[model samples]
Target: MPVQKMDVFDVIVSGAGPAGATTALFLARAGKKVLLLDKEKFPRDKICADNKTWKCLDIVKELGLWKQFQKLPKAEIYGVLVASPNGSEMYTPLHEKDIAERGHWYNVKRIHFDNLLAQAAKKEKNITFKEKCAVVKPIYAVHSKTHISGVTYHDAKGKTHDAWARVVVGADGSQSPIAKAVGHSPVVKGRYATNTRAYFENVKGPMDRCELYYLKGICPGYFWIFPVDKKTCNVGIGMRPEDFERQKKSLEQILRETIALPQFKGRFKKAKQVTAFKEWGLSVLGKRRPCAGNGWVLVGDAGTFAMTFSGEGVGPSMRTGKIAAQGIVRALNENDVSARNLKKHYEDALWKILNPEVKGFRWLEFLLLNERLFDFVIAKSAKNKELIEISSRMQHDYTLSKKLVHPKTALKMLLS
Candidate 1:
């Protein structure tokens, strides 16, 4: 593609992660000239577990990248093993079609998975996917000085340049420049989580199932071991910032101690941690934040779409990217860039799908976080198929989220 005027872009997307790349792919398909910018290079390493919700897969398919995804290395998972703080354990089978379109869930490393999205965006003729270019600040129109005009960025070699667009999409992570420009705060204590991710090899456990252990001090969050293949598994622990601070131990130290507990003695005796543990921050939607403003909109972590209870990210990121693109396509046609315009066209549509979900699951999060109740529920679910089924459906199925907080459901889980 030949260089054009700096102002020739329909949309400028900040960050080439899942949300930005997916948004660019969709907008390009809609015939928009898109500039997808990222500070990192392609095939960059992101510290994360090997879990991809079927919804994430659906977006990959929608972008016509399914065939490419199929060729990547992954583990086919069919069920989950959940253990309580007191060591009570339950195994719940995840049914196909109910949870995923592929009839199985997939677990692939973030390094490979994210790079695939960036590559797909580059394939679009209308998209200029510029890696190693970091957006420095927003350029506001002089007249309004409220809506975005474009952005100034520094390239890989630190050369500064200005790029303009009719609309700007902030698909950047939690600390998005565009989001800040629109008066958004990056982290609020209750709505955020910190996670430490690592990989382990030669683990002794069921290779086809995901394992989650609810630990003391880390209510709602869990230490998870997800299979990446026959020999390797992605392992991690997630906790609210407050919980992590209270523990007063490094994530690496806590992880090691937890593995030494009698309940996990057998599983990790032969296992070797294959990667250094890395800690990162995540913003979850315990409460929704405004996403659209004057000439700009936020998606993915910038919008706080990670599930409140599960700390889920990839699926929601892709989902918002695709949904936002639909609204942006309409906005482009209508030539409206006001905050109110995008509030109706984009934000409303997004929250309609997300509002109830995060609100309902926070109830589930509160209920199961108590150590005694966590133990009781796992013990009962082990013997009662109904309890196990309902527990499995609490996620991926939204109908039960509201009921999960009902007094009847709480009593049923406790007494029945």
Candidate 2:
């Protein structure tokens, strides 16, 4: 997978999503020559819940896209509306302090959201942003196979080209070629989720609250109708591939049947699907993957950063991209791209920031595994404002997410 023709940069980023775009922008701003490549052209359609939490907006502000993002066509989300199998429910609002300070959460379609960042990246003098360039594999230094030197990619013309860099980044998605080159592939069963989504217009739902449903059939796997605006909603469902096997239905079938359920049918009676149902796989393990290595680091899905319980990745991806930039900048300045420095500056530092919360959610994911427990959890949460507040913060910054698995919290859910 080596290439004879070569171009060089200070950093080569493999994907141009939030993670890669953020990394490229930060690196470029730091005066690093960045080669940012993406498999698709700009304004491409990406299947996502398309919601960006307030925490995600913090990074958007940092990237200098806030003012522009504010001008985009989107929804300002206030909270989540969740229902359990028995129809017991809870609505967890974003912390008021944050809502006052940052205007709370948003639902921006990924097409507009990603293009905003990518367009910004393209404008940076230090960044060479290439669209429609698909990476083939990472190029390792001839002397050391462990040290990634750059990448080989297939251009839009199907011609191969090489781009060398002091450090290469695998910001590519879960099925990353670079990830596989580093031996991070072979998707682990039960650590994965199969999901399906589609856009619909004329859906009747609360625009300010994301609607989530946990039903007997879907059980731990869940369904959502996250409104993008007044007239449209992003409808989707997720299931553990292992669990989905027992259902004996396709992801599309599950989504269709879920929508056809009596309760949902009333809401969508006049709503029309604007897009075809699409399926995607996610790396949902809360445990950290090997993200940093000699001359390279992974971010976003490539690093398996999608949340186990919620399947949310945008916030984590941008957060990791921001940190990955810091690591790359430090590495470039010190002229050390070894595994040790990247780990210290990137991996270790990242997990230190995310581990507790992530570990906590991993523990809490158990609640979503069963219909009975989910019903109880939602029921208790609706009755207890304190519970709603804790659940709200848990999605962002509750450090002791694991504690909820024990103590009076568990007891409260059991006995309430």
Candidate 3:
């Protein structure tokens, strides 16, 4: 672990996923030299259903990547279908349109989507791409007792290289080496909350619809089947670690029982596992705290910006990266890299944009955990046209506002 010879960059991004790629894109576009490093090569794959909502689309457009984004094979997910443990069901469609205003969201394979974004990042003149480079640790200065100056990494050939940057972005994700090297402790405990996901292919269904089955007693979590393509889908269940402990069943067992439900048994008969089962402990959420110190910041799952209820992070992660890039660029322009100054970017921009949504999602998570309320919503949702319409809209703010009905509204929904 001798410090390797260093090459300098304005920004050294540790992860080449959506967040890191987008951050590099923004930074490079601003004329800052960026070195983007990733442990995986291009066309790398990741777990999770690959879905992007308008929250992410806006950033794609801002980065002038909308057109390319459109070229990918995308299935328009009309809305989500939710079923209660008791068998009652509801469908919610997403609202928003592209050119013709046809659909509000798109689903594509992450392998393709992530590589596409990274390719876009490569097109930037100021970015130097390094794939298969595993970051070892953050290069820190003893004097400041703050700020990560660079990173030391090992390449596929066992060659070690060090790269220095004015600022470091730990977009390296949940198991971030840079985050750990910088003295950031893992807040997510494996014993408390953990998630398991399994990916399958050749599932029978309309590619445009994703389904969520809410099981009673499994509060704050749901079973999901997200279609990635005509032939593939992400079938998984995420619940409290305590639930798994109590039941003492494997993740696959829960998932198999879920697929055996009458609604899915026939449709998923042809499905096959394309990837091995995967499990990861989610990072503990940092509600309003600044994710950056003096010279480094963490984005994406590394910062646990995933929605507590939905477990959706792709859009928010990319958005956070863009906002982080903006902050870093501004700090560089002002010749200050202090955490206090850089904190303004997250405080004024990133958190403000996502805080309400996170709070709303947290509330929904709690409500879903309450079996009485879960049952009430499912039963009422089937008959409540207003609830159905609002649910279909896919706007978190609107949905949360309307869904938190008062007694009068509740009466109206249930009676009507």
Which candidate's TM-score is highest?
A: 2
Question: TM-score for each prediction?
Answer: 0.94, 0.95, 0.91
TM-score of 3: 0.91
lDDT string for model 1 (1-416, tens) is 99765555999999988888988888999999999999999898887666787779878877778899988888888887888887788887775456554566788888899999988888889999899999988999888878896889999999999988888999888888888888777787677778887888988878888888888787667899999877899888888778888889987788788778787779999889888899888877766678888888899888778776667788888899998888888888999978888888899998888767766776667666667766876787688766666766754675565564566766876776
**Model 2: lDDT of residue 188:** 63
Give the higher-lDDT candidate: 1 or 2.
2
Candidate 3 per-residue lDDT over residues 1-416, each given as its tens digit: 89756699998999999899988999999999999999999997787667787667788888898888888876767677887777788777665443235336777878888988989988888999999999988888667656789889999998988789889999988889877766656565531356667778888876788788787655556788887666777788888777777778887787777779787799778778878778766654545655887888888877766666567778878988999999999999998888887888654678777766766665565557677776777788778777776665535353364354446667776676
Off by over 4 Å in 2: 1-5, 400-405, 410-416
Q: Which stretches of candidate 1 lie over 4 Å from their true place?
A: 1-5, 96-102, 410-416
Comparing 1 and 2 on TM-score, the stronger one = 2
Error of 3 at 119 (Å): 1.2
Ranking by lDDT: 2, 1, 3
Residue runs of model 3 more than 4 Å from their true location after superposition: 1-5, 96-103, 187-193, 284-286, 394-402
* lDDT, each prediction: 0.82, 0.85, 0.77
Candidate 1 weakest ten by summed lDDT: 95-104
Task: Give the per-residue lDDT digits (tens) of candidate 2, residues 1-416.
Answer: 98566698999999999889998999999999999999999988888899898657999998878899988889878888878889898888888776777777889899999999999999999999999999999988998889999899999999989889999999989988998889886376567878899999988768887888877767677899998876888999987777788889888998999899998899899999999999998877566678999999999889888767777888889988999999889988999999999999999989888877766776667767656766777787788766777877765665656555566787876676
